[model samples]
Target chain A: MHNLEAILAMGLVTLLCRATPFIFFMKRKPPAVLDFVQRYIPPMIMTILVLNSFKGLRFGLAPFGLPEIASALAVAALQLWRRNALISIVGGTGLYMLLIRVL
Target chain B: MHSNSEAPRVKVLGPAFTASIPVLLGYSTIGIAFGLLVVKAGLPWFLSPVMSIVIYAGAAQFMAIALLAAGTDIVQMAILTLVINARHMVYGLSLLDRFAVCRRWKGYLIYALTDETYGLLTTVSPPEGARSESFYAAVSALDESYWVAGSLVGAVIGGLVPTEYTKGLDFALTALFVVLLVEQIRSIRRIEPYAIATAATVLAFVLFGPANLLVIAILASIAGILAFRRRLP
Candidate 1:
């Protein structure tokens, strides 16, 4: 019910956002500064997004604790190890889950 | 338009495939986390990766989840997502000249103009006298494939994970970006963008909060870098 409606809304939003880039830039690439942006923005944004994810850092869904610290450490470690996106993700998630469940 | 027979598709294909291995591995895991998080948030099973594949924009997906979790309206969600992803306008314009020559591949290339793909293609000049169009096509397709494949993997993992266990996994995206930036820094001699970006990020975060920080940071960095470049020579 609520979930389904949200999904539909998300789906619609996703479609339009994803397609917007293609439509605007069709057969027309901008200059070098823009090119630099296409390269650099993601990494910068990712840093912010990741940090924000842990902003309210909590355990049992409320306040600062072990799980966030552990997951952050795991993500940093895995990222350094292979620089492989999938591995970093799985490794981080797996470690987070293990910590939450066992520790 | 160059006929299909003249395109050196394989030459471009090889590098695209080789380069994407790291991307595939990274994106799949990221996708998996996305899947687990969105599903954990109580979204439908089918929509998680569908958004990934269709939208194929990671940050936008995260925003979508946040907005959905709060029961925000469709129009608001849609507009916010658009504002967030509006940076692609810059990416598209940068590739205007290169794409102009790629007639047959243009339509599909336009469809797949993601951040990662644009990053790789814009930096690498095609081999002398080789088909630049083909190279662009190969890189574009390969990058999109990594994203699509990663999303599917995430969807699969989300389907299996329980909601209570989904915490802290979100940091994976952060770690992933750190790794990527470090990698980019290694190849780059240009430190101005890095410096400008760091400064802009700090400024934007303080001024605008995290919501519009990335866009503001990028715009500022671009201006700073351009000004600095004029002083270079």
Candidate 2:
């Protein structure tokens, strides 16, 4: 029962956050402060997300985040070149898997 | 008779599917990962799709596994859900104009606005000659369906794979995030946001370590942006 409740609670909270803007802006223009947030936050969030992925890697440890670093670099370069998201992801993951096994 | 009526609506499906193919790949792999983890944690098969439907936030679901394992309560899960997926509001706000005219689908649209869907919608316009709402609806539904289907498959197959064999399969999610991050950077023109955000993440990691890093990074990024906004412009 609690598990189900937790799921519903999560869904409801998610719905509320998503609905907040649409409801608030239904009758009025969003404020300038919101405009600032709208403009600047996406990149910041994206950067944070990218960093979040590697948070488990101990920088000072033996493998030293090398596989992640190499794969990330490969992802960036491949994406920049081909502009194909699927290629970048697959290529990077493949390289990461290989590096982890080899090194 | 039903087929005749459905013809126009079905025409929109192709573009939507094409646009969503990348997410189909990302979500399927990550959804599988989350499903496998949940199974490893001793949950039932149906719970994977249930959680995917309700707690549709992909990244947050990964975080939730730890809490679920620890037997966290509903209230705590709700709060955690809010904190992690709070970014959805930003994406929602950005699309307020586009979504305003899409009133009837607003609820459904908001519900399906995950990061990959949001990013894809940001880049791609509605298909030519298609009903605008239909295009958005198609893309949204397709993405979620990919996730649900993936989780369902993952749930069924999860127990079959030995734990040792699943190593580094988890990197698919990270690789997907990196791919989207690259997409975000390409769309964005400035260096300051990236630089400031990097510094904030590094500083937060150093100060707070991994446990509190998310809250710290979010705060630092927001603060850094506010303080530096005037300077930038």
Candidate 3:
């Protein structure tokens, strides 16, 4: 019951967050802040999300986040070269999986 | 007449499916990991799919495993979920223009806007003849199905697969983000947001630790953008 309650609460909270903008701005003109966020924040948030993915890395350790850095660079490079999302993701993830095992 | 009505819907489906392929890969892999983690954490296997269907947020669902294990209270869990998912509000803000035309599917679109779905929607343009709302709905529903299916598979076979083989499969999520970030960079064609976000993330990590990294970094980045708005292109 407790687990169920927690799940429901989390779900409600998440839906609320996702819905907040639509609820507020559905009928009115969104403020200038909306334009600012829409214009500049997508890339900013994406960059942060990409960086946050490395939160578990141990930078001070022996490998020193090398696998993550190398794999991310591979993904970015592949994406830049081929412009295919699947190829870049699969190639990068495959390389990371191999690197983690061997390194 | 029926074929005429159906033609553009068919056209939208193709591009929507193509755009969602990366998310299919990423969500399935990560969803499986979440299921495995849930079972490994000694929670009932059913909760994995339940959470996937209900919460539908990847990081928050993962965090819920730890929270449940620690016996965290419901209110606290809800609060943390809001904080963790706060970036989604920004996603909603960015999507206003795109979703403005989606009156019929607006509610479902809002509910299904996971990180990967949001990325795909923001980056991929609807085909010329198809309705944008229909395209958005297709991508969102397809992504959610992939997630639920993956989680169910993982839950059913939770203990069967050896942990070693699945070690870095979660990297697919990061790779997805990197691909999306590259797309964002390409379209935006500006360095300020990227630089500001990176700086803010580093600052947040160093100052507040990883526990509060995302929200703090997002707040700082928003502030940074506002401060430098005049100079930005």
Candidate 4:
């Protein structure tokens, strides 16, 4: 029941979410201050997200563990190697899962 | 700028509908994962779509599911959702350029300024002398259509599939992030983002416990950015 509700609700929200921005800003470009803010903001937000998503403080050999840290490294390498979003995801997640179970 | 007085409306609408195909495919995968998570969290599957429509934030939606599962209060859920998605405030900032033109549509744009759409728009500057609003509208519609379709597909699958198979589906979010970050790193000549992310992540894990690490990460990254601002250009 919950799944069903989530599916329907999320579907509409997703549509509206995608639509609202264009609907509002389709006619204009952001100001200089906004451009500046956009430039610097994502790094901070992403940093916070990555830190909070971690499972543990200490892992096998170092502070970073096999799951997230390894995945992060994989993402960086793959991005440098391929420059493709889908490929990096597959490589990073696949490697992370395999490492968690194997090592 | 080509005005509606000269250009046909269908000309603008056609591209928006067509571009949604790829967006739809990506949304489907994530939507399915979300559907599965909501169900696993023991919330009514039907209600998931409602929240998805209203809140419309991917990360926040997932967080909402977790909160709902834990029986979190409604007020707490709302506040947390707002905090987690505060990044959208920046997204809004970027849209100000295009948004100022469509005075009547401001309300809807504020509602729909999502991460994916923002990613697509901010990176792609419109051609000069073109009617940007039409193009923007098309992209926005395409993105929304994809998301809606994805959620619907997820719900249908959730209704049919067994619970065990869906257990591992929540991974789509992390996988998506990994992919996006990788893309960012690929084109990024400035290593500051990488350095900041790494240093902040390490410092956060060390000084603060995992729970408080998010705040530390934000601080460290900001500090890094401030320190290196002169080198950005």
Candidate 5:
């Protein structure tokens, strides 16, 4: 069985991530350094996460991880065209699901 | 005067609930998928709801199922959770002015700022005569309730399903993050952050393999950007 205490600890950590800025910034503005970080941190993080999702794909293997790469490109294209997050996500996930089944 | 105050509060919630419908749909399905993964990892079915109610970070909680099942230590799990949810802290940066008017409700708003909630909260304005405090709280609470309810339902569904049936459920996470990335890229026309993130991640992955590379990439990207901030937009 997974440790329930550990799960709760994870919960505490998440709450900390979500809450610390509010507590710290309540009385005063965030420092200039933080302001700079905030401006650039988000896009950087999102970009890394997108690449990180494709962490380990053996190029020589069958299916060759085509499903992940294809679906990601498709999702990006659909998002760029439709500009709707829900549509892009659902459509791309649907495509990925289909590809996994067929390939 | 109390009765007069309560009426707009009621009207306030109507739009907040309406605005949250999209999150309702997204969270319910994604939340169910998340709950199923937790159960698949051999936890008791009800633990899904508990985690959903408490941890509530979409990808972080999903990652937890794997890390916990693998018997990873608390410090690693803690750091992993922090790294995955780090972007959330900045969502509050944008909300400083929006949430400043709130008193009692601000705590709840801060606690519930998930990616979906933050996206919605930032785009929409409050309805006429509706206090921003109640409006924001209603959006946050409604989105959270969808997640909690979906987890309960997904847990029950997880109990009934065969393991193979949920095979592609994890793709939903990849799809969600990619969608967010695309949105971020589109919103900001600058190419520097994208270039920095790509270079840092590729360097880290090559140097350290897949294990804990994100933390390194994030740190590298942060320092990289700060040093070059003057030259780039």
Candidate 6:
């Protein structure tokens, strides 16, 4: 019940975030902040998220974060080259899975 | 007469399904990863499908696993979900005109407006003679079903596998973010946002540690962007 409550709360908040613009800005012109966020926040958030994904890595220890960095660069390079998200993700993740064990 | 009349329905349905193929691939894989993560984090497998069906936000659902593992309170969980999913607000803003055609299904369409679904809806047009609302609804429903089905599969697999075998599988999430980041970069073709985000992330990690890193970094990035707004272009 507790876990369900938490999940539902998150679901409600997510719905709120998604629906806010449709609810509030349907008729009136949206604020400048909305435009600013649309233009800037997306890329910023993406960068932050990619970096955040590395939060669990141990930089000072063995392998020295190489697996994470190498795998991420592989993901980026493959994405840039193929432009196919699925292939890039699978390839990068496969390499990471192999690398963490071998290295 | 029957085949002739059913022909038009096929025309609409076929193109919509084709358009959803890319999303079907992306969502299923990522959704599976999320499901494995939920079980790996010590939660019940059933919660995987529940989160996918209810929250339906990929990044937030992944974050929820971590939040639950940490035993975070409902209020904090809600706030984090809000921050992570704030981008959906912009998505809804851009979608208003397109979704206006969705009279009966507009509410459901808005609820299911994810990053991939938004991209497809905005870019891909319905085939000739098809209703736009029907096209949107089909794509939305198909994408969510793929996600839910994929998560269910992963959750079951997670329960069976030795935990060690799934060790580096979470890298799938990182790879997803990287792929998305590359796409974002291609579209924006700007440097300031990336630079500000990097700085904000470093500052947050050093000052606050990873505990509050994402929220603080996001706030700092917003401040940094606002301060340099005039010079951006």
Q: Cα deviation in Å at residue B67, candidate 3?
A: 3.1
Task: Choose 5 or 6, whichever is better by DockQ.
Answer: 6
Choose 1 or 5, whichever is better by TM-score: 5
- lDDT on C-alpha atoms for all candidate structures: 0.61, 0.78, 0.88, 0.58, 0.78, 0.80
lDDT of 5 by residue, A1-103 (tens): 4467778888888888787778788788677776676677667877887788788777689899999999988888998899776677778877887888899
Better candidate number, 2 or 6, judged by TM-score = 2
Deviation (Å) of B168 in candidate 5: 3.5
Worst 10 residues of 3 chain B by lDDT: B1-10
Which parts of model 4 have CA positions greater than 4 angstroms off?
A1-37, A42-103, B1-27, B37-43, B66-72, B98-109, B124-143, B162-188, B205-216, B229-232
DockQ winner? 3
The DockQ ranking, best first, is 3, 2, 6, 5, 1, 4
**CAPRI rating of model 5:** medium
Of the candidates numbered 1 and 4, which has the greater lDDT value?
Answer: 1
| Ten residues in sequence with the least summed lDDT for candidate 2 chain B | B161-170
TM-score of each: 0.63, 0.84, 0.93, 0.62, 0.75, 0.72
For every model in order, the fraction of real contacts preserved is 0.26, 0.71, 0.89, 0.23, 0.73, 0.83
Q: What is every candidate's C-alpha DockQ against the true complex, given to 2 decimals? A: 0.23, 0.63, 0.78, 0.21, 0.54, 0.57
Clashes of each: 14, 0, 0, 37, 0, 0
Question: Tens digit of lDDT per residue, candidate 3, span A5-102?
Answer: 99999999999999998888878999876687678867887899899999989989978999999999999999999999889988998999999888
Query: lDDT tens string, model 4, B1-233?
Result: 86653474456565544433334545666776777677777766665566656666777777777766776655555556545554465455445656667654456556666665655455444444446666676677677656665566566565665545334233434544444454454455567877886788787677765654544565566667767766785
Where does the lowest 10-residue lDDT sum fall in candidate 6 chain A? A33-42
The alpha-carbon lDDT assigned to residue B49 of candidate 5 equals 88
Instruction: Pick the lDDT winner.
Output: 3
lDDT of 3 by residue, B98-207 (tens): 88877888999999998778877887778897888889999999999999988887888956767688778778878989998999988998888999999999999999
Candidate 5 residue-wise lDDT, B139-202, digit = tens:
9999999999888888887456454554565565567667777777777778888899899999
Native A-B contact fraction in model 6: 0.83
